[model samples]
Structure formats: C-alpha cells, structure tokens
Target chain A: MNAAPSASKEEKNAMSSMETPDAELVARVREGDRNAFRKLVERHRERIYRVALGMLRNPDDAMDAVQEVFIRVHGRLTDFKGESAFGTWLVRVTVNYCIDRQRRQKTWDARFVVDNEWEGVSEESPEHQLVNAQIGEALQRALAELGEEHRTAIMLREVNGLAYEEIAEVMGCPKGTVMSRLHHARKKLQVALRPFLEEAGERDLADRAGEGVRRRE
Target chain B: MNDQDQEKLSLFLDGALAPEDAAEVARLVATDPEWKAAHRALKLSGEMMRAPVEQAARSANFDGLWAGIEGRLPAPERAPSLLERLRAFLTPPVLVGLAAAAAAAAYVATRPAPTPAPASPSPGLAATPRIAPAPESALAAAPADASEPVVIEGIESEGSKTVLVSQPVEPGGTTVIWLLDAPDAAGDGAAAPTTDDDPI
Candidate 1:
C-alpha cells in the first residue's frame, strides 16, 4: 500500500512534467511568469503567421493577424480554462481574426488592390524564378477572386492542412458545411486557373519531350 | 459533364467527397475524357496553391505590421491584471503588516523615535498582537436593548479577533461589523486566522 501511493505520486509528477509548453506556461503565467509566456509566443508565432497568410493572402494583413493573435492570447491567457488544446484555440483565433478583417475590408471599396502580386523576374531570366513568380501571382489573383467563405475553406484545407473537423471548428460551422465549402472552393479555383493550367501543361509536355530527345542524342 | 456531374467531379479531384461517392466519381472520371480533363484542372489548381510562393515578399515589413496591430488594440488599461488581483488576495497578512508598519513609521516620522525603545528587553521576542479574551462582563452585560435585536453578535475572545472572525448573523437583514473588542492601541494585529475564515 505504501509503495503504491509513492508510485502514483511519482506517476503524477512525471505526467505533469510532460505537459505541453502552452499548458505549462499558462500555469506559470497565472503565477506571473513573463518568461514562460514569451516561450509560448515563440513556439506558436510562425505557424500562426502561416495560417494568417493562407487566409488573408496579403503579407501585411497576415503579419497583423499574427501579432494580434499573440496579444489576444496574452491578454486572455487567464480566461483559458484549458478546455481545448492551445494550438487548436490559437488556429481558431487566427482564422477568425483574418476573416473579420476580410469582412471589414469588403465594406470599403472592392477595388482595393491587395498586392498578393509578388515581385516578378525580368524577361532576361524567364525560366525558373520568372515562371515561379508568374504562377504565384496567378494563383494569388485567382485566390483573391474567390468568395470569402470559399477562399478561407480552401486555404485551411489545402494550405494549412487542418483536418475537416478542425476546419469546421475554426470556421464555427458543421463538418458538412466545411465539406461543401471546400468542394465549391476547389471548383471555383479550377475555373479561375483553367487557362493558365492548360498553358503550363503544354509547356511541361514540350520541355519533357525536349529533355527526352536530348538524352537519346 | 452536366453542372451537377461537373460539381461532383470537382469535389472528387480535391478528395473532399465521401469515400463511396469518391469511388464513384473516380470510376467516371477514369472512363470519361471530359470528366478526366475537368478533374485535371481542379487537381492542378489545388497543387499550384499548395506550392510555396518560392520567396518571402520583400515588401512585407513585419515591424510595420506589428506597429499597426499595436495601434489598433485598445491600449491595456494602466490598471493591473487579474494576476495582480490574485497576488493581493493571497498576501493579505503581508499587506496588513505593511500598512501597520507604514502607519507606525508615519507617526514616528511626525514625532521622534524613542531611541528604538531601549533595544527591546528581549531581541528575539519582538511584539506580536494576540486576541485577548473579551471580559466575561462584556458578553454577559448584553445591552439592555437586547430585546431590540442584537445587530452584530460574535465570539471576540481568545484568538478570535474581527480579522479572524466569521460573518455575523441576526434574526433578519445584514450588518457589516467586526468582532474585535478594540484595536490594539500599542501595537498592530499581525497573527490572524489562516484557515478559520473558510467556515463563514
């Protein structure tokens, strides 16, 4: 009986030590540990920034979403009763903030030029960097033209790689809604990028055949 | 493919259709040229988006983004956070002691220190307030108007000062009153209840 009590106590301690940094930091943060809070922020910032980029498409808006996520997380740390995993909560907050920003932007002019357009290479180097930039810009433009719900759903699924259930949770909707949105988003993207895709494919075939002939020679 | 067939094919290309439905769509797309072309386009778009943008946008000034977000956030109130509230709640004795020391220091500052009270006959036995029992007469004397209802009644004797006392009760209504006989005019009350407060 004595050994059993000691064993259980040691087991509890071991489990606690293995707890995630977010929960550990939360406990310490409640005790006013600033260092612990900084650690938590550092762990999540990059992933949060990536999620923001997927949703907003604009680097500036995405970066804003990232910073806001950390601040809001810090401010509301105490209210985190640990009901959900910290990453799950952070993803939800990041997605919601970007969507809210998108909603607000819509109220203004539709012609707001979101420069998802990145810098392109000159005609002098039209092969590697240029093609990549052209494809990126085309993809960004096509994505921007999608409706808000479709865009976010596609971004979460394809870009962020969140599960359908996780996407549903983040979008504050049902799994069926997530599936429908993703389906529609995929359809819209196919229509928007069809011309570019066909061109890319023709180019790919020509390049492959050229490479094959050169090898034979 | 008709619109409905086209829509189902699109979803299938992205792997968003249910398992059984997806199997059906896959069979159709494999055998049907038009459906195959449409699926190819959908698959291509998804793949293109999944590809990295190759380089980080040089125009993305993360510092500026941080500043903008900070500007928009309602500046935190200068007041302390909930953590501060909890710290204060936990250290009631420390605060009470500090307050008493401050009051004494202020009085001493105004008057003169009496040569440190001759070094206190015993250096180890520094003064600490104790809950002296209320005289029997005080409890027994029950105000002649006891019939009028005792507004606040409590056990003020033997280690039960107001700081250590529980809430008072009456026939009806509530009145906030402490159980202390009187503040120790000479010293400050330091040792108070640590656990008894949980009762009421």
Candidate 2:
C-alpha cells in the first residue's frame, strides 16, 4: 500500500513539473481561466510580494498591494499583449501599487505623527539562517529614511533584480534618471550601513585569511 | 579618474561595457591599488544592494481574493432553466383555439337540436326595417328604451312618450341603443339625434 501511494505521489509531482510554462499559463489567464491565473499568482507572488515589502517596508501594506496588483491584472489581462515577460509585467504593477501606498502613508504620517517605535531587533543571531533577516531589517530602516521615489527605484533594481532599463520601464522614467536615482540610493545605503560594514570587515578579512592559509598548506 | 575611465568603470560594473572596455577596466584594477579599492567598493555596494535578505511577505490569498472580487460584482439576473425554455418553444398558441373547437364539438355531441322556436307572423309594415331608424322620422324621434328591444313591455316612460323601435342586432350579442328627441321639443334643448351612423 505504501509503495503504491508513494509511486502515485511521485507521478503526480512529475506530471505537475511537466505542466504549462509561465508564458502559456499567462495566456490561459488572459483567456479568463481562473485556475491559470491562480498558477500565475503562485509562481510570481513571492518575488512580487518581496518587492512590495521592500518598497513599503510593511508586510500588511505589501499584502494589500499584492492583492490589488492581482485584481488589477485580472481586470486588464485582456490588454496584456505578451510583449514582456509575465513576471516583468507583474513586478511593474506591484511596484507602482506599493509606491502609491507609500505616498498615501506619508500623507497620513504628516497629518498624524505616528512613530514606528515597535520597529524591533534589526539583527538575527545564529539561530536564524534567514538570509539577510538582519540586513533586511536594517535595510528597511535605511530605506524608511529615503524619499519614496529613490526608495522605490532602489527596491526595483535591487530586490526585483530588474535591469536598469526594465526599472525605467516600470518607473516611467528615462534610463539616465534611473541611474541617477540608483547612484544616489547607493550613497544613502552606504551611509546607513557604514558602521555595520566596519564591524563585519575585520572578521570577514580574518576568516578569508585563514581560508587562504588552509588552501596553501 | 578620467571621465572616460569613470564611464568605462560604470559600464563594466553594469556588465554593459564592450569587451575592449571591460579588458581595460580589468587591467587597470589589477595594476593600480586605487583602481582596485574603487572596484572593491563598487562591487560591495552592488552585492549589498542585491542581498537576498528578507523573505517575501505572504502573498494575497487566492480564495479570499476571489471572494472579494465576487462581492464587488453585481449579481447576475436569474434566467429560465433549460427545460422551461424548451417547453415554451414546443407549445403552440392555437391550442386555445383547439380547446374552443373541442368544446363546441362536445356540446354538439351531447345535445339533440332544440325544438325550433315558433316563428311570429310578419308585421304589416311593407318596408324593410333598417338596422337603425332614420333620425328625422317621428317614430324614430320617440324616446328609445335603452333597456329594451322592438316592443318593450311593462316599461312606463320615465319622461316623454316612448315608442317601440326595431333595430337589427349584431350576431355576437352587441346591442345598439338610440334615443331620439327633437332639439326644439325636448325640455332640455340638447341637439336632435342625427341619423348619421357616426360612431360615438
């Protein structure tokens, strides 16, 4: 009995892996197939949610923005001409919605002074292998300090891993402007992270030296 | 750094520099400590920016999302079921007509022809009776009993003298009522009734 069930599970996994690619899935979504749309949301939601979270720096806001992004995509699926990758299109939508949310939050902050006092531990000690959890918290803090446009450009280029041109497309700006924003963003991040870099550098250098010596002998 | 070198360095870091430009940057970084330091700083910034840090926030829930979408859409109007539509298409309107014909046949099937009503002797008047009497004629001028036909019995005139008028009636139980009085003679000077069969 166990053998038969395991075999069936393996077969199902294999069959799923052989199923439609993202492009075909998107096409089916455009044809109004809800299941296909769900597949698309599943495939790209992680990156999209990450990008939104990076921009908004709040998980709740990111969730709302992601939901709005899908709703908008469903509304306009017929207009998607397949000129760009579905991932790229979704990332663009996600970025724009987050930026809008950021603007609204800023307006709210201006009228009512709300402090992010609950902003908790910026570092995760060894028990967490969570990549950049510490860095992410620190980055979020650093990002919170920048203007919305600059922060969004940085998130798009860095987190979404979009090329400068793609970022430009999403941002509705010239490539030169994108470069300017990114250049400024780097300067800002370096300023924010200088102490962390200083503390980590000496240790990283020592570890690298030990590895080099081990290789030599 | 020279403007050309700076441009080349930026392009190289971006992986957009041509092969020759890339080679030049690589050579400069290898040879010059200043170039190496700048390159290291630039690369570090790039990696820091690209750090795959925080895990993604949970994405929109599919079921909740669809529920919200459904809530926003208007409810569709109820349509007739397939069987009802099919039944409507099959039934003909003239079936009512068929039912009337069947009833008439059934009545004919059950009854012997009723004894013919006795015929009355023809009146002495030589002229054919009109479907409606001429308005100018005196006999036509008599106040007609709206409730009675030709020779109404037991009706006492509520006003001036009443005259029995003969009027042909239509087959489907339609009765024509006419009241004739001279405009000058009637106490209320309403206009004399016209012979014109003009519809009221």
Candidate 3:
C-alpha cells in the first residue's frame, strides 16, 4: 500500500491551528475511537447540515440527511483512503445522500427546498431580522425552482465556497460541466429573484432617504 | 446574448475567466446595457446563494444531529463474520475476479438438465417450462462455508442478471461487497461498478 501523503508545511500550520486535525481524527476513528469520531462530527456537523439543507430543502429532511450521511460515513470510514481532504470527502457523502433522498421523493414542486428557515435571527433590531427573513425566504423560493443538478452545483459553488474543481469532484462531473450548470442555475435564479432584488433595493433607498432626513433635522 | 457570450459572462461572474477575457467582459458590461443587466443579476443571485452557508451556524441543530448520529452507531468491537474478513483483502481489481468466479459458479449451478422426451406428445400440445425462483427461507437457512467464498445468482429482471459473491478479507472487519462490471458485461452500460473505497 502507498504511504499516506504527508501534509505540506502550510497544511501542517493550518492543522496545528485547529484543536485536532481531521486526518488524525480519521486515523483514530479507524482504530475504533468513538470519541474521535464524535469530535469529527462536532467540527463538521454545521457545514454538513448546510450542504444537506441546500440540497434537500426541508429542515426535517435536511436533518435526516445529515444523520444518514454521518452514519454512512461511520460505516464506510475504513474505506476512506485519505486521498482527499476529509471535508471534501464528507461533503461528497452529504451531497450524494441528499441527491438520493431527493430522487426517492421525486417531488418537483415542493417549497422550503434549501437552506435555513426564517426561524432564528440573532440580529438585535427587529427591522433587520424582518429584512433578513424576507430575503432568506425569497432566496429559498428561487432556489427551489432550479433543477437538481443546477441547484447542487450552485450550492457547492456559492454556499460551500468550493473551487470549480472541487465542485466538479463533489458533483461527479467535469469542470466545464460544473461551470455550465452554475451558469444556467445562476441565470434561472436571477430571473426568479429580480423582483425581490428590486424590492430590497427600493427598501434600501427608502431607508437611506429616512436617514438623510434625520441628519438634516 | 449568444451561448458563447453567456458562457463567457458566467465565467466572468465566477472569476473563472482569464484576465484578458475578464477585461473583455468588463468592457462589454460597461458599454452594453444587456450585459450589465445580466452581470448585476448573476452577482445578486450568487450573493443570495452564498448567504445560507455563511449564516449556517446560526440555524444548525448540532446537538440534535450529534445525538442522532451517536445513537445509531454500531458497537466498535462487534465481531465480524469470516466472509467479512475475506472482503477486506479483496480490492477493486479483485472484485472483477470475484464477479467472474461468481458468474461461472452460477452458470454451473443453474444450468438446465436435459431429460428424455416422452414417447408420445399429448394430443393438445407440449407445455412450456417455467422457472421458479429460489425460496427465500431456503436461501436464508443455507449455511455458508467459511473456507470457500459463497456465490448467489438470480435474474433481477428480464434482461439483467445479478450475482453476489462473499469473500474473506483480513479479520475482525465486516464483509464489504464491492460491485464491479463483469469482464463480459462491459459496453452494456446497464450497471455501473461501485466500491466502498470510491465515492459514488
């Protein structure tokens, strides 16, 4: 068997900054360390949840997908050859599980398709919370209208901040395919969200005008 | 505008375009109203799509997720079957060997037996032969040998055949079934090979 590749100097520095490196955690898990597995979950659960939510849409479904993903990860942990970053592998699992679940349901018209709901806004100002909720809802609605492949690409690119190549790997497609999917997805989202953007722009303009009046007074 | 222009604009929006191409797009966006509109829309859409992940921490159910995952985990020290042990040694390439062996075994096991025809056919006609599937109970009760690999074969549908092979690997680890395209099954594109080591 080939030796696991050594972490580069920059990678070592980055992992040193963290409480425990993912590779170390994975190694421990492989050796039957449940605590290490839990730690890995603690570190990556939020991002996994977000990716699940992006693909599955419904909060309950997303949560279920998150659980299924980790379970599959645990079952297949031994097979993880450490060929890629743990986060990349985990994200791939999450995306594939969500896609499978979505296919099973086969619902095209479902609402609440992706991301966090307008439940908890930590903003102190009620106005800010309301605006955020509105924008969030609008964005979710627009995302729901996209095709599965398009939505997956957009989520990987925009939400997870994966590079084109990483997105390609996660989606199991070529870089060019990823770009094309993102382009089409973005175009569709823009068309769907133009009204919301215009409204938000108007609201911003009105808010600025009110501030100007207060300053004048 | 055109497909090429749109793709270029998309690349520009994603910052994937080369510096020269980006500059060209920037000029177009500056000089062309349509390109500017498209750019603004794509930019806004990208921002909204990105917002969810940035704010994901605020909405994630971390405690619940951990609880769910922890509850479903199997015991780490649970003993695995001997077949499971053999599977660990069988890598992706070895999967094809197992598949071929399983197919050959299946053909030998399920091959039809010829019998002498009756002296005279019935007045009406000969009856068509029907193949019955193996009983589930029999399959379940059958004991698998630890020394030799086990092969199970059946038809999944009209045109598709399924063969399952269990082989031993190292030890302690559970059996993992790695499905691969059979050598003779290539170019059919019916079933894609998948292994636990590789992400599907």
lDDT of each: 0.59, 0.56, 0.67
Give the least accurate 10-residue stretch of model 3 chain B, judged by summed lDDT: B114-123
Q: Write the per-residue lDDT of candidate 3 for residues A96-138, one digit (tens) a residue.
A: 8888887887764334423343334465478766665665666
Worst 10 residues of 2 chain B by lDDT: B121-130
Q: In model 3, what is the error at residue B27, expressed in angstroms?
A: 4.0
lDDT, model 2: 0.56
**How far out, in Å, is residue B173 in model 3?**
57
| Better model by TM-score: candidate 1 vs candidate 3 | 3
What would you estimate as the lDDT of candidate 3? 0.67
Return whichever of 2 and 3 wins on lDDT. 3
Q: Candidate 1 on B1-200: residue-level lDDT in tens?
A: 77688767755654667999999988877887567667877765655554432133333445454444446545445567899988967697988898999999898589521111111122221222333333444434444323332223343344533321222234333321222332452145333322223222
lDDT, candidate 2, A144-206, per-residue tens: 677777877866765556677788877888998987776666556655555545545555678
Off by over 4 Å in 3: A1-14, A17-19, A108-110, A113-142, A194-217, B52-56, B78-200
- Chain B TM-score of model 1, please? 0.31
Question: What docking tier does model 1 reach?
Answer: incorrect
Q: What is the interface RMSD of candidate 2, in Å?
A: 9.9
Best by DockQ: 3
Sort all candidates by lDDT, best to worst: 3, 1, 2
Q: Interface RMSD values for the candidates, listed in order?
A: 9.5, 9.9, 6.3
Every model's DockQ: 0.13, 0.09, 0.19
Per-residue error at A127 for model 3, in Å? 14
